[model samples]
Target: MNSAKSPAKKSWLQTLIKNKNERKKVIFIFTISFLLVVAGLIYIPIYKHSLPLDSKIYEGNFKELGSIARIGFFAALAIYPIFLLLKWKPLSHIKKGNFELKPLIQFLAKYVRQWHVPIALISTAMIILHGYMALIKGFQANFTYFSGIITMAVLACLLVMGVKRYKRTDKKWHLKFAISFLVLFMIHATFS
Candidate 1:
């Protein structure tokens, strides 16, 4: 009788309320990263225009790259939330310790894990592309360049550590590195 009601009688909201700490952490990480990305998009152009005319990176014709950078920025900005939503389903399961390594769950984890790195890479790439354009057509390469470099490093670390986490069947390093990278990248993006 108890086994039968176990799945049906439990409410999702109740479960969240019970594990508020983890849920809060998840929300915090997502919110901070989202804000940073959005903020970066807004400030990048202003920073670029602040560059001196003689800077090698900021002096080139960048109309096309600028347009592409805009597209890339918006695309990256939009896709991140969707990716988070998709992973949220499984994340809830994992948090509940209900993650059975069955074929379906395994398959979902595989695809979702694969999806994350490329999205992050593309997002970082777009940021870099934007920075490159700014370097050539604007004066302030210091902030843009430093931000781009840090973003790339964070993404790369996330990817490498991510692969290890997935294959090792451990979530410890995954959470540590993933959260660290996200936080650091957000800071770099927003501060630069």
Candidate 2:
């Protein structure tokens, strides 16, 4: 029999996938990620080498795409603090029996909350595109690619963790993951 005194079965990975919706999210994310990586690892090289040397992204809109991806990366990063603020309600003034800006805070929170998922998805897509392009061209052995891979993978996990309510106390884990990703992303950017 399930006893009341039994401690809840908590999983480190369970925090990342909290609910059915989140499970769906992770599944979709994994699918997309796998396809992109596989294409980069396999299809990209084949397609590139099979084509004429003149037919290349570097010669055309690849730079523009990369720029868009860069912008998306920063945009997603910007959301981290905003998200923390919203979720944590860290403004002490707002909590100390303050009613002057409750509605305003709620309004801002609503907007920021809506943005979290879309921002994560868009940024993930952009990073994948950037990586795919780089890989297609020629994925060399360098810290840049390695760091980027780690960053992107961590970012995906972070997004998945934030997607749904799996555990009540997952915020700390999310925070940790976010910080780790930010650090890794910085390393990737620096090496880039």
Candidate 3:
């Protein structure tokens, strides 16, 4: 029953998900997400009071936790460097026509696989803490909290999917979830 001109059954999204270049694009998307989160935190005043005499981040014991969260944010942002190094070695290997990726890629991939769960958990916690700080400051506006909340949720889902994929030993689905999460996070960051 097959015809020479039989049409492709897969949708465009399927095609996109299967694209080879999507791997590196996914990494860059996360890099941009990291930058956006960092930038937003920098420019936005974290604590706003809905009521008089409320605790401000600068003037209270909250400062310590805030500092810790800030440190975590910076660390999370810094992790992108590992991604860059991973990409560099593989890209160079590929460019030289070596079908075999550098051994470093395996090392990097192992770290990327093993670390994602804990990283996502800590990152989710930090985002919550940051949101709490934001709340103490009265930033309940639709755009701020809603977008931030959505972004965190998307990231959490992505992390869970990623971890599941890793356990199932499926690289394709892992990258798909990761890329979708990155895209959602970026949109969320932009709105926030």
Candidate 4:
């Protein structure tokens, strides 16, 4: 009976792993759990050392720099989705049917594709600067900061996947990571 149950359990596990959607669900669940654990670990220390709400660090230009960085980041983030919209099936049909708009849509698509990587890199730099300034200000124990940290981590993974995609070492992972990063960033931004 024990041996028979072991084989059944093993086959069940194998089936779960063999299914692509199931594998993705498992990975997503594990990733969220790991991030939560990491967040908890980091949050405690940061919360302990966090400054009072009214405490001002140096009255330097951090705020201005952060604002600029955010704008730059959003500009970069918008490129890919805009490019997607340009290449959407409905839009493609319109482009095919409407000769006048074809040139405009094609031009926009090409331009956006050309700028995607460069803008992403620039935005990454801006995010780094923004995060550094935020750290200098103080790490308050809040959902906003936690979400930002998670977004940053996802962005790092997205960057790696982007490089892999560029090098032809990967195919779909970059897009998946990009979508994940976008969702996480939106949450972070909205909360903040």
Candidate 5:
């Protein structure tokens, strides 16, 4: 009978309450990512249908590629935050023989933590393709265009830093650059 109530089959909320902070952070990031994508989906058709053809700002000239890139970008944004959750304090407490968690949580965390690098590499490819279509195809240098360039440059620096995994490198720069890129991305997306 105890097997039926095992943690493995518990609702996500139950598992989450046990691993509170990390789960909360993951939920928050997922919520934001979902909202951003949904907002884009809602806004795109309305923008196209409601506005004049001349000012249809985001017909996204490259259509399908643009759509795929936008989705990939939001997905990457969502995945990046989950990295923090992988650093479990419980792991250190294991030596004390006092650790307890659902097997499902353990499995999920391990899978997510292991995939961070791969997710980043995939996101990079999608962003590169998106950038190429947006900036290189016609090569327009404006506020919208330059903001994207700056964001992309910083994002590339971040990827290099992640790959290097330098013990001595100050991590604040990573946080700072990420915030900077986010602001730049907002501006770029808004004006583009």
Candidate 6:
């Protein structure tokens, strides 16, 4: 009886892997797990006093420059997701034979796509500067710092995926990374 159940269990697992929605759920689970592990790695050292913190370094205009960088980062980060919404939402409508807004959606999507790469590049630079300003003031083991590091790592992956997508060397990973980055960035921003 145990042997008879073995193939059935294996087939069930295989079927789950083959299903698109199930596959997505599995991928999401794995992604979240990986991110949690990363956060733990970052948080544990600071929690244990292995990491040094010097609050004195926060002097000077670092705060002001960090604020400016934050503003620039937000501005650039805001645009790309609009493009994704514009590009994607219309497709579902179109599938249902609703073409009333097709032309307008396409036009907006095209315009947004044109600006996406440039804005992303600018945002990357702003984030780098922002990170430098913060770290120069010493590392603080807080939600904001932890989230920021994870968000930055996600953004780096997003940038690489974006470049590969642009060069036609890949397609789907860029969107995945973009969504991940957006979610992580939101968390980071909220804590800040």
- Give candidates' CA RMSD values in order: 16.4, 6.8, 13.5, 12.4, 13.9, 13.3
Per-candidate TM equals 0.36, 0.56, 0.44, 0.58, 0.49, 0.52
How far off is residue 53 in model 3, in Å? 8.2
Candidate 6 lDDT over residue span 1-192, tens digit each: 355544444454355355455455545545654564456446544553533334434433444544554565555455565656665754546544555556666676665555455445554554665575577556899998888888888888887776576446656787778678767776776667
Alpha-carbon shift of residue 1 in model 2 (angstroms): 30
lDDT of each: 0.52, 0.63, 0.55, 0.63, 0.57, 0.60
lDDT of 1 by residue, 62-154 (tens): 434434444444443443455555555554354436544344545655555434434444454445555555555545558656765665676
Best-fitting candidate, scored by TM-score: 4
Candidate 4 lDDT over residue span 1-192, tens digit each: 455544444454455356455445545555654564456446534764563433454223444544565665566566666766766777645634437554676787676655565556655655665565566567888887788788889888887887676456667788788778767776777667
Instruction: Give per-candidate clash totals.
Output: 10, 1, 2, 0, 0, 0
lDDT of model 1 at position 32: 58
Candidate 2 residue lDDT tens string, 1-192:
866697788666556655556556656766775675566557546766665535554535444555665666566556556555656544545644645445565676666544445556655665676766766666778887777677878877876666532454566667678788878877776667
lDDT of candidate 5 at residue 32, scale 0 to 100 = 56
| Candidate 5 error regions (>4 Å) | 1-67, 79-107, 166-170
Which parts of model 3 have CA positions greater than 4 angstroms off? 1-101, 169-176
Candidate 1 clashes between residue pairs 3 or more apart in a chain or in different chains: 51-139, 51-140, 52-139, 57-135, 57-136, 58-135, 58-136, 58-137, 58-138, 59-136
lDDT for model 6: 0.60
User: For model 2, what is the error of residue 49's alpha carbon versus the real structure, in angstroms, after optimal superposition?
Assistant: 5.8
What alpha-carbon RMSD in Å does predicted model 2 have with respect to the real structure? 6.8
